[model samples]
Target: MITRDMTALRAVNGGHALLRAYDFIICGGGTAGCVVARRLAEGGKATVLLLEAGGSHHVPAIMDSTQWMWNIGTERDWDFVSEPSVGLNGRTPPMPMGRALGGGSSINGQVWARGHRNDFDSWASLTGDASSSYERVLDIYRRIENWHGRPDPRRGVGGPVDITLPESPIPLVEALIASADGQGIPSADDINTDPMEGDGGCGLPNVLVRNGVERVSMATAYLDPVAPLPNLHVLVGAEVERIGLRGSHVGSVVFRRFGQRYEVEVIREAVLSLGAINTPKVLMLSGIGDPAELASHGIPCHHALRGVGENFQDHILLGGCIWEYETPELPRNNAAEFAFFCKSDASLPTPDLMPVLEECPFASEVTARQFDLPVGPASAWTLAPGLARPKSRGRVRLRGADPALVPAIETNFLSDPDDVRALIRGVEICREIGNDLRLAGFRRREVMPGALRGGDLEMFVRNASGTYFHQSCTARMGRPDDPLAVVDPMLRVLGIEGLRVADASIMPEITSANIMAPVVVIAERAGDFIRQTHGLG
Candidate 1:
């Protein structure tokens, strides 16, 4: 039995006061961090410390499923901004990352999309690990999800994360599903299962919501259960500065809490689950990046790993093709309930475009300015077309050595002409679906980008383009021989001892849909590796 005072455990200074050293230190109590902490500490074999930069995830905005978008730009968000991209007509889109306990999972749309099977197979091919194969990853998904829908062997039961389809979907949502079927994208009972393994389909999405009202974030599902364990210590408002090194092995971790600096020794290992941006930023600050880049910031290089922050990738969504509703229907569940995945070109091997039907109006600042959009709570819908597998890649770089300074992110969205072409086709598909005869009873009028063609369509795609908030691949995993591989197949950071990265940052390629499910799988696999290595089982 574990014993720890609950009130004191959450205080900013409580963690350092409790212990100066821990068996394992997990940074960033986000999605992966929470999962890793629970898996490691639940065995009662390791003393784990989970440090989160932001406060708690108990806020209303994080708990309410309908208000998921309300968390963006709030205190819970990291509120990162990208460098101005010429691809978007010199626009610097705001990149919102969750700083709280649940990280992106706390504030995201809660869509439980397990990306296409090809996505995982690609990772298996790159890393030469059968564990990453689609069949194996599917087994992991089945083990983690506590599905609420009808019985299906493909899904699991009695797991930590509760997943369910939208109950009592609005009539407009039903019409949209019908419209998708009319447009050659057939409807399926569930999108998370077989639909993802095939060519393309549409249906109500599985959301990370429990009891139809509460949001089920990784913190709530995983961390909250094991939080009282004596072997587990959770510290909120703890901003990691950098990792201190002893020779080539991790020595200790330094972080700031309530304006006070504290250092804690790491007896076993340190895992970086700080998402893509902060993970690389932390590495560069600790002198574990490219020698030239570290020297440019006046920092001595401890480990000259060239690929600290390269290969940045994010899903780009054009927000979007809008339609006015014939009658008002308030949003339900997570607001965006229905979605479809398809290929931009028939020649493509798998589905590369994923467009979702938002219950409310959705548009980027530039797009909203360019078009006359609905205002003042008018009933409307948006078919936001997204490019799932982008050909273009971006990189994250350091602005300075100070941890307080935000890292410079170059999103480079739509930089490649192929991405622009695919998005143009995607927008066209969205328009067709929005105007399908099956949706005639619900759609009043087409609002934006009506009958546009050629340069105008391409321009629309550029102006409407923005991130889906699925930022990944900054420090990807690959075979050791791969030059750009930052972590090994087992997620161990190359050239660094007692250090591993187990978040979306390790994704070799961004998945073909929302990445929350895939990220959980990554954390699960990382936990298994850690336990197997230390004989924790």
Candidate 2:
């Protein structure tokens, strides 16, 4: 149901005639898209059309944060698969993404981490835009999030999304943090308290779930709050097929809804918030990618931008680190209640590795697919150590012109030797924490690479590593002089008028933490740019 909020952006579309024109057409009403929609439509100033490819986020199983694992690979997921890589022993990996209104926020682990200061500052430096500086992004974060746990005025208070530190952490988590401390990793009260200062050691996860059960996502926070707005029309189950280009600007966006095709004329502009994977695919499908690549799929090149689908980077973590605790306790929200970041090699600039502390037997996907796992009383905790900022990059290319067909995603995980070495250090750090006396009571023993070291461990990483689901930089926003920049520092498509790209895809580089927070910040700023550009606000 399209919410009818009159005070905010009035969004009421009754027929095809009403859909003929819109001030803004936002594609992919997922994580970042929802934010863009609400902000743009504020005070009934702009008629915004938000098209989500999936249905609403009312699923009880999905809304309940604990049932996140069940949503993966299900209908609610994009279910994109990566190409076979030598790292996984020629086995392709499954890349599950949220397909509904709130996007990944509806089905993710709810860990809302706003990466380190270096993350955003680096983007500001790369794009030569002070608007994306860490200080500006931090203020935007305060506006986007409603801190439920702490009353830190520094962290926004009455914002939309409800973010909180872990609730009633289990004993095992305490032990793990202590163990991490023993390994020279400092203890962090929270990741958001000052990311640069609390950058590493043992840290608590700032989750999106409130009161242990209820979830807070873009739909619940941003969209639903302004549901009564008449200027904001949220069309669910509307998959944008291709963006029709005009002589000098975008003419219309063709989408399919309920088995019927619909084309909405873009009066002002269109924003792509289709995430890292689908964003590039949509660009390529719209004849905006590399000339040769688009031609290969029989897609006529309208605006040949070679960097549209290139420079794809994702955080791939080797889940080979595991442990079976005899009586370990876990959190009510998600198993991964605690975490820490560290530089595997001090010579590296920032922390290149982060170890996620999950209170369960988390083995490789290969093991989980063909093996049995225990839960709660029958289970123990595991340390899933991963590389933080990977140097290896990949791409998503169109397989065909069909909109329903997914693109071929190649993450190229562990392709960089430096990335491999970083993960090695992560594993070594985990081993150090696992054997520390602080967790002696809960540590049963290493479930993977029991006694193996050196080359054997490297081989284990090749077979056990998987994506952290933090994919970014497919439609990277870079310097004007850089030939590979798909979008400018302002997030406007390089050669396309009436079009812009927001979301994780526009990130010049992936953040050092979970990407949800950064996505919100990007959308917040994007909304500002749009309003300022078109004189809406």
Candidate 3:
């Protein structure tokens, strides 16, 4: 039986239609989309419509924090595969994104890192929004998170997203921490609350997990609210086709479900949260992208937005040595072995540590380079060094006029020599952190990937490098003079009005850490942007 909340969303025609003209039409009811939808609907400030490409998240596996990734390649995933990469010796990469109501947050490892303040400030500098200041962003961050495990004045106590440290830790983790201390890297009691830069020690990493489960995703925190708001509607299994534009302003979006296509006109504005890969595709389908590329695909250019699919950036990673544990039993649940944050050139204050039990891989080498790292053999304890600021540019182009066809994504990973050098540094740091004598009691010899010894180090890097899977910036935001920019500082797709992209796609540069938190922050700010524009705030 459909709950009252869902029944109120159903249209008279058996669809979800809450208002004659929705104040906001949010496409892709994923991470950022849900937050925006929930906030807008909470106070009945506006009628919000949220459309999702995939269906419900009621399955037991989806809620299981440890086995959530098993949902990959299943029915609920977009299952996007990247174009062949020149960097990975011509192998293609598989990028599994969440298609359910919560988007990737529903199936991610649930690790939560707010990243560095400089990352947000850099975006503000480019966008020219002084309000994008670090302090302001921190305010938004604190407002959204409900830290449960410990008392942190820096952490918000009552928010939708539940943040906490690991419930179960491996013995190796203790050793890694000791090793960091041994190296004079002071322990940062709370990395999430501490400063992003400077000589700092490792802290107990936080995650978007609660009661050993994932939380703060779109469905859990946003869509699960009580009904009768009278302005919000959610539709699942609805795939957006294109955004219909009226001259310079977007009029509505056309989407399809169950062999029937419908168009919903937006009285005010529309937001796209289809992630970095699909946002540009949606734009090009709606006749926005590089004029030459669109024209080649028989799409008469409505706008010659040359940068619509440019400025792509992502973090390339290498796996660490899978040393056997004295306990000798593989962890039954999803617990990070540890995490590490390192520099691009292996020269930094110190590496922030993370423990990971899973890794992202592809069937071929071609797809892995989209993030600018060569598909090489390397391993770490999930130590990832993101290409915080990348110089290389890539594109997302329509395969055809068929909106059903996913746009072909090409990320020229390692196009810049600097990205590769940083990843190499990451590999070295992982080895050092992994083999620290402080954790020696748990260290068994190298297992699956083999030892990282003299002649084998290069081979490990060449064979082991993989994607951190945080792809972004295909529709980058920057100053108007920035040649490769797709959106203005306000995140409005340039040359287009009444339309905005709020997912990771609009990031000027990928953050140095996981992106779930930053994406939500973008949505929070964008919600305000929409409200202020409409005089509703």
Candidate 4:
């Protein structure tokens, strides 16, 4: 039998030679978890331990920007499946979120749009915290990276994450810009500015790419530097089953490695960055969810908070219109432009209508399953939008106590009549834009079973509209007055001490833009909140 020294693994309850317990234990070293780890470890005051459920982020598929998406369902992704949706004709689609060291940030399209200022301020208003304020969150956003080396006061400079326009080599992106411009859609130089909603922007799609590689991922930006720190440790391929509790405080986490279960104690706090799906599952499994639900599954309840898995919301993206351009050689490498528009053409009192982009297809769609749609020789893309600030909320519940079984995610899309109307409007607008004269030279005709004047278009939409993958709202942050609120304003779990949820799950509402950049910003701010509350140097 292979064995090690017993003393080496033994814990020293109280001793001077003993390494201090981590000031923070971050689970799911993903987009936000990485940022949180880095910010806390920057000054070397707090000990940080980051645990990731997946394997390494150094996979070859992660480096190649175009093929990065291919890594989704492979070992790198959590491969979570949502509950069958009645809204999308009872189809249960797969939600491929990165389960690796860098989490979804490493495998995503790398778009770096920061969404609207109002998105943050709305969150702040809900939480009653100034840090959640738009201006405060904007400061955190600017602190992350240089925005394409420009001297824009709005963009951050000299940060770890490198933000820039997508490099050429993906040419369909460029033609999309030209198409939008020809249609009189206004081009935005800065998509992250306050009140970010606009008609259309000609600027290149901003990305978290650096030196021809994905850089904004937490593994690259945060843990890469402090991983060797004596106080900080990272475990890969570790699946957390539940958090161990004592009275009302989270005492430790029980996880599996190599078919053996191990428990790691946390002296300070345990932060859950397990994304939307797994975060709620962990809470439910740990007896921190609804009492009745736990009792039905033969699991005990630690806290009977009903909001643990409630408030689930994800964007619904519809793939429509294939444009085939007749060119001697396919344009392989060229920069792409972007356009953001209000859902309604009419003006809003304060832009309450959170409709953002119409073209360039990165954040524009979060595909639940990419291969489900039929592909052909001509470049096939989608025109996607979901009601960004959706009024309807869903839930993530447990099928059983088993962590291996994926949680039941009910993404109540188009539950609101207005959201359905918005999708219909989005489809109509995308068709109009695709059929414009500017695209006449580039596109041959619609290849799908749909036509300009047929019911097949409706059939196509019914069959094809898929999940945008921007899942959030479970364990949401809100004031004590709101019954649906899971976490309090301080990012702390209600009725539980020394525990927090610091990823997309805590977002009061999903942002209109791609979530990677915003998730990082959220972690950055959360790091500060943790430090200040704990009085860390």
Candidate 5:
């Protein structure tokens, strides 16, 4: 509880202390939430209150970039599960969302990527707002990044998140890169640059580690640096029960902290940054969902906003092409050192497939369960090929009216057959990239999924495919005419005042890259929007 406590100095109606009102109340202390808190409270412009349902991010596993894999599915992660899907032949995968201060950014592989330029352009076109175009969003990206590489037009310095390339110790990684080069895919100097030089390039992955060692999550980069602000209050371990809306306006939020219930007042507005899953869940629990659905849960409907928990999208990858390594080696920081982006089909405007080469045998947590995997070091490595722009869509709905229970997420992965074709192309690309002269000595033999082709390969994709941990668009911002549009171009809830969404939930569509970078840009834009509307000091 970082908020100043002056309850003993004042008493309100019925012996209660003042409701701890603030000019802005930002919910969820995750990636974007922390940035909003810092920007709003900077220079004491506005009295800000940031509430997180989780605890401090002081755990060593979370602080250490290389140890992030250990935190997944632990108390640090929300450990949510997907509903059974035919896509995986009726497998329910567990989602590793960060239940700690930094949200998914903390639990995710520390890869730092801004995605392709066309991905954000697609978002702008959907919203019909030029502000969301890649050009405008790029400025915010520049502002948020503090790249470890030398200064350039594409990179920025002295920013919150310090992003750099992590060292790769394995010989398999260089062999893979050389193989891709032999196939005519050159290196990308600055992948984040607009019209990326290597839009079709394959190389080592850039990471969000500070000094190439520690994880520089939003908690460490944004909130911790601004912790001294007198007007800023960050309440940790405070679970928000529901948002209280009074006549289409965000009134307050009811929460429980340390076994005591509290009602926090919002002087001006409330921003929801609870990621894709919880943001929609909160809206539905607060009576802002479909009227019929709300009544089924014994909750009166505040607004019949049917789009609160729909249009869910996640990155699903066909599990790796594993090969035995000649010597013992292990992944240090950010499991996957090499990454690739290329077109599955040239007809598409941008690359639709990405292959992430990891030093270890990598698979989504769920995929690891269905098949036999080698455990010993130097045994095998993987080339996990992913379908970046999937046509398949899913949904996130409330398990019940209770905010404590994890919501039911129906990923419905590979429901669209187009995804299968795209992934098949990725597999072919991986095979092409793997069969290079550089890899002749290091890779002894193909292990998992070896000697499998066509039908067998397709079956492998169905059983092993799972998320890249980029869940988004449950409460997207879009054009007014779009029924699925829960928020406007500026991220304001369609029919509600004094409420906005500034996280992955508001993304009309998920970007091609890990969502951490895009979410930061969105939150930075949101901070500007709030100040413009309410005149923050």
Candidate 6:
């Protein structure tokens, strides 16, 4: 009974009419949810209901490019904190996720990085699906991007997402690229293209900003245009509790809005694009996870999918190698713009280290206190070395049956010895680039880990270590025979019919760069599968 009026559909807080059933119910109006909902509803072949736990994405802090950081810890953010990590000297770091309509795309750094070719190739190998290969994923990328830079056959034009290189990159950014080039990492015209396919390279990254001013999130690019569609209904502030299943098939979605509980039937499918954490939490709550874990929460297991919350992965970034600027320069574009991808060791097959240049000093609280770093953004710059291919794995578990409580998150960052070794090498590479002769004019002094080596340097990496906000791989896709596989190659949840996951949680492995682009690819592919399955044009 939801109306199709554009203004009325902006955000239905409460007191909105509810239809008995919809052709599709997409939970969590995040990046993937926005894309899937648009695709399913635009064909006019079906009715779709998109539910978002948070409010709208029209806030100034989310729209303005420079004010992106301001959204963290605000009402728009799901300020999740990880348990104390033994690797970081028992520190519990904050893991902020966007709760607004656009999800992380609204509050993220806006770096548009289509992961390396190997990242997708590995997915193909794991799921035994050629469509998941790099060649196929590249085609999808081409079809989705509205590239603003020099025309290239590898990139798409006239697509929904506006992608562009920094129009006027600050001098230091150029110097950082030069410094990286001097250290054997060649600079490329566009890192998302041919550069990422090879071993690795440095370049000015593409951003999801329009006219170098406003952020073009997935919600803006995909959802907003189709908001007026009569078949599509969007509900904001609707937090889903669980998926109601009739035996093996998902029948309905139960959610809470304004402290009122409601259940809406799903005529065809129920897609969960609720991110890495919430996706598995919802599944487990619906009696679809490990049997013992569900029993502990006093919930009976309807389906025993042991991989519901396992294989959790995230890119680890050390908050940085800081250098006081000789002269303060105003930040341009996304504050953290320039980036380089490279191998920590020569023997490694692909690039494992991704160091991004932050236009301001970026550090963890522990590292900042340990180093006594400057707080002013204009005073210094940071080269945050991120572990692109971390071997360590973690898991998410339910605290209790209550849907209101946050799930227990175990990031387990830097738990693997190899991860520590790789990060140490990454820090060395960052230090070498920060002090290179090409950056002499910009560097006043090296702030932290100046000459530390051996155990001291390792300690620095641990203290500075934090998440890149690319949480994924918990409810991963794999072959049916694979015991830990939660979803199949087509993103359908194992042992559950009419239920699919189209988000970062479906990644078989963490990609070798910012995961936003890879996530969009997942969502697009999901849309294709769902469309073909139901005969939607």
Clashes of 6: 0
Best by lDDT: 6
lDDT of 5 by residue, 365-419 (tens): 5456755677764467788888888889999887677667788999988999999
Clashing pairs in 1: none
Least lDDT summed over 10 consecutive residues: which range in candidate 6?
Answer: 1-10
Model 2 lDDT per residue over 434-497, tens place: 8778777876665665655788777777777888888889999998788889999888999889
Number of clashes in every candidate structure?
A: 0, 14, 41, 8, 0, 0
With candidate 4 superimposed using the best TM-score fit, by how many Å does residue 349's alpha carbon deviate from the native? 5.6
Candidate 3 residue-wise lDDT, 217-278, digit = tens:
55787677633455777888888888988998998888787766767778888999999888
Each model's Cα RMSD: 3.2, 3.7, 5.3, 4.7, 3.7, 2.7
Off by over 4 Å in 5: 1-19, 194-198, 364-372
For model 2 the TM-score comes to 0.94
Error of 2 at 507 (Å): 0.9
Regions more than 4 Å wrong, model 2? 1-18, 149-153, 195-199, 328-331, 367-378
Model 4: per-residue lDDT, tens digit, 1-537? Answer: 212122223211121122334567888888888888777777777777677778777766775554565686788887877676666667666787887888887787677767676678788888887778877776887788767744677778877877776555344445555665565544455556533634323445576666554345667777777665565666676688888899899888777766666667788888999999889999999999889999989999889888888888776655544443443222221112343444444443223222222222232132324323334322444444344555557898899877777778887655675665566655666556666675566555544333434454443454555566688888899888888788887788999999998888988888766677778877776787788888875
Please provide, for model 6 over 1-537, each residue's C-alpha lDDT reduced to its tens digit, 9 standing for 90 to 100.
222223323335233455668899999999999999999998799989999999888878899887787788998888999988898889888888889999999999999999988999999999999999999998999989999988888899988999999878888888888889999999998998776899899999999987677899999999989887778888998899899999999999988877777788899999999999999999999999999999999999999999999999999988999999899876777888799999988888889999898888888988888786866878899999999999999999999999999999999999999999999999999999999998999988898879898988888889999999999998999999988899999999988899999999989899999999999999999999999999997
Question: How does each model score on lDDT?
Answer: 0.88, 0.80, 0.68, 0.67, 0.79, 0.90
What's the residue-level lDDT of 370 in candidate 2? 36
